[model samples]
Target: MAIRNCLVTGAGSGIGAAVAELLSGQGHRVALAGRREEPLRELSARLPGPSLVLPTDVTRPEDIESMFAACEESWGPVEVLVHSAGAGDSARLESTTDTMWDRQLELNLTAPFRCVRRAVPAMRKAGFGRIVVVASVASKVGAPYVSAYTAAKHGVLGLVRSAAAELADTGVTVNAVCPGYVDTPMTDRSVASIAAHTGRDADGIRAKLAAAQPIGRLILPGEVAAVIGLLVQEEALNGQSLMVDGGSVQS
Candidate 1:
């Protein structure tokens, strides 16, 4: 396998951190980008290979440019990009505000879109690149009380497919990994939100979520990272939204 320059957003923790760790172990130079500098630096210190800790807010275009510039300055253009920075909040459709809707779109859909836009040009010139967006199973299916999140995920999956088609002849492949109820801090927050909204026990909500997957357990962040590792290594897998859920959506 080639040791490429990789950039992973949301690398402070969860799926992003796992992906960064896996790539670094495989001898890739990784750039850790996240909002918090401490965690990024902490992750960089532990990585097996070279790394750059870049604090960035993906919601800001200027910050995105700065992140790419820093990566370019350190190890050259990003040959592999994994966008795992996202958040989800639950609300009934009627109660979902414009702020909530926009936030979801910005974080989940627009940020990845911009990062791909920034990376693809160089990838086309080099004729080799891998881009993976850590999407959710919500990208595939609709559920109650998460209309905004579902819409954003669906749009991001569409973005992946369209971008992949456009870049079919290029060496760059665009794809998304859709995992269900991953055991991450994000899911922890989801559990809290659901419990607060429904006046249910948080532990019970979590158990219900785990059982939602046929495997009857929350998906592990490393499991999703392994799937991302596969996408990064395989050039033939483009424009596919792979389901990392335990056979929940059999697509």
Candidate 2:
């Protein structure tokens, strides 16, 4: 296996953190990017090898450019780019404000676009790169009260597929990992929202969500990270949206 210079966005927590840590452990030089500087610094300090912490807001083009520049300066050009920065919003169409929709789209869809756009030049130059977009199960299944998030994720899948096709013959691969309910801080917030909306206890709501999945539990962050690790392998997997939803949606 090659020692990749990897850049993982939203690496301060959840699946992003797991992916960054795992890649770092595997002897890859990883650059952690996120809004929270403290967590990114802490993760960098704990990881093996030289890990760079680029505290950045993915929604900003300048910030994205700065992060990639810093990564390149510290660890050379990024051979692996994992776009795991996203946010979910729970709101019905009638209740969702234009601002909320725009915000979600900016963070969930356009942020990845910016990152990918910035990475493509370097990747093409190297002629060997791996790109992974972290989408969601909502991309496949339309869930209620999350129209904006679902729409953004669907767009992400489309973007990944298009990029994959464009780079098929090149030594680069573009793919997406669509995860179901992962047990992360975001899941906790979702549980709280459900409880508040339905007047149920947090544990009860969590139980209901778990039972909704075929596996009878929320997916772990490490589980999703494992799928990401597999996607970056030097194989023929391209333009595929691999679901890590524990049999939630069979696609």
Candidate 3:
């Protein structure tokens, strides 16, 4: 297999970092872009393959644009884009401020759209590309206290499907991976927040989330990355939402 020129957003931590590491291990030319530089640099150092540490704020359009430009300059046109920079918050409808809702959409949905926008022209010109958006289980099923997050993820799924359909004739593929309760820093904070609010131990809260999945364990970050890896190589799975939610979602 050719070593793809890949760009992973949120590569400083969690699923993003895991994806970057996994791809780099497979000898891909990976660029790590995130809000923090230190972790990106640290992860880059750990990789056997060469990597670019691009500190980027995905929510800022200018930053996102510059990050991709820098990535292309360093590694060539990104043949694969893993949009892993996202966040989810627990806020019931009544308590979900408009600002919070807008920001969630900005980071989780709009950012990926913009990234894809910049990536596709090059991808089309080159004739091969793979784009994966890291969505959440909230995109498929509804949960309380995360209406805004659910809405944003839902939007991302829509974008994936629509874009995939548009590019079906092209060599590029667009897809999404929806994972449930992954054992990442985001889930750690979620567990802690629920524990503090409900007077339960964080471990107990984490266990509950794990139990909600049929597999009865927190999803591993590598598990999600492996799915992305498969999609990047796959020729037939375009426009799909591959679920890595421990069998909680079937379809």
Candidate 4:
């Protein structure tokens, strides 16, 4: 495998950290972007290959620019991009506030749009690149009690598909990976929040979430990471939203 210069957003933890570490292990130079510096710094030191720690809030256009600039400066053009920075809430539309609606869209949908602007140009110039958006099962199907989350993630799929169409003939491929009930820190928080709201124990809520997957368990972060690694190298798999939900949202 060629030593591609890759940039992964939300690299401090969850799917982003998993993808970044896996890419680094595959001999790629990774640029880690996240709000927290300490975790990125720690992950960078532990990576198998060289990495740049660019503590960035992906929602900010200026931060996105600086992140790409820093990565290019250190490792040349970024040949691969993984967008995993996302946040959402579990609220019905009637109960959702303006802040909740906007933040979900901004973080889950708009940030990828912003990051791709920085990536596509560099990728187009080089005539080779890969872009993967870490979307959700909510993007594919409707789930109750998380209207804002579902909307934003559905928007993410739209963005990914549109970008994929436009860049089809180009070497730059855009796609999405939709995961369901992953075993990560973020999911732990979600489980806790659901428990608080429903007056159920965390274990029960977790079991319910896991049972949503036909495989009867939570998906591992590394399982999703493995698919991302393949997408980065598989030129033919473009304009796709590969679901890693253990058959939770099968089409």
- C-alpha root-mean-square deviation, each candidate: 0.7, 1.0, 0.9, 0.9
RMSD of model 1, in Å?
0.7
- Residue 107 error for model 1, in Å? 1.0
Q: Candidate 2 on 152-228: residue-level lDDT in tens?
A: 99999999999999988778899999999889988899988877877889998888888777999999999999999
RMSD of 4: 0.9
Off by over 4 Å in 4: none
- The Cα error of candidate 4 at residue 173, in Å, is 0.5
lDDT of each: 0.95, 0.91, 0.92, 0.91
TM-score of each: 0.99, 0.98, 0.98, 0.98
Model 3 per-residue lDDT tens digits across residues 1-251: 69899999999888999999899999999999999899998999999998998999999999988988997788789999999999887866899999999999999999999999999999999889999999999889889999999999999999999999998888999999999999899998899878877899877788899998998899999999999999999968999999999999897
Query: Model 2 clash tally?
Result: 0
**Overall local distance difference test of candidate 2:** 0.91
Give per-residue lDDT, candidate 3, residue 65: 85
Q: Candidate 1 versus the native: TM-score?
A: 0.99
Compared with the true structure, the alpha-carbon lDDT of candidate 3 equals 0.92
Q: Better model by lDDT, 1 or 3?
A: 1
Most lDDT-accurate candidate: 1
Candidate 4, residues 130-161: lDDT per residue as tens digits? Answer: 99999999998888888998999999899999
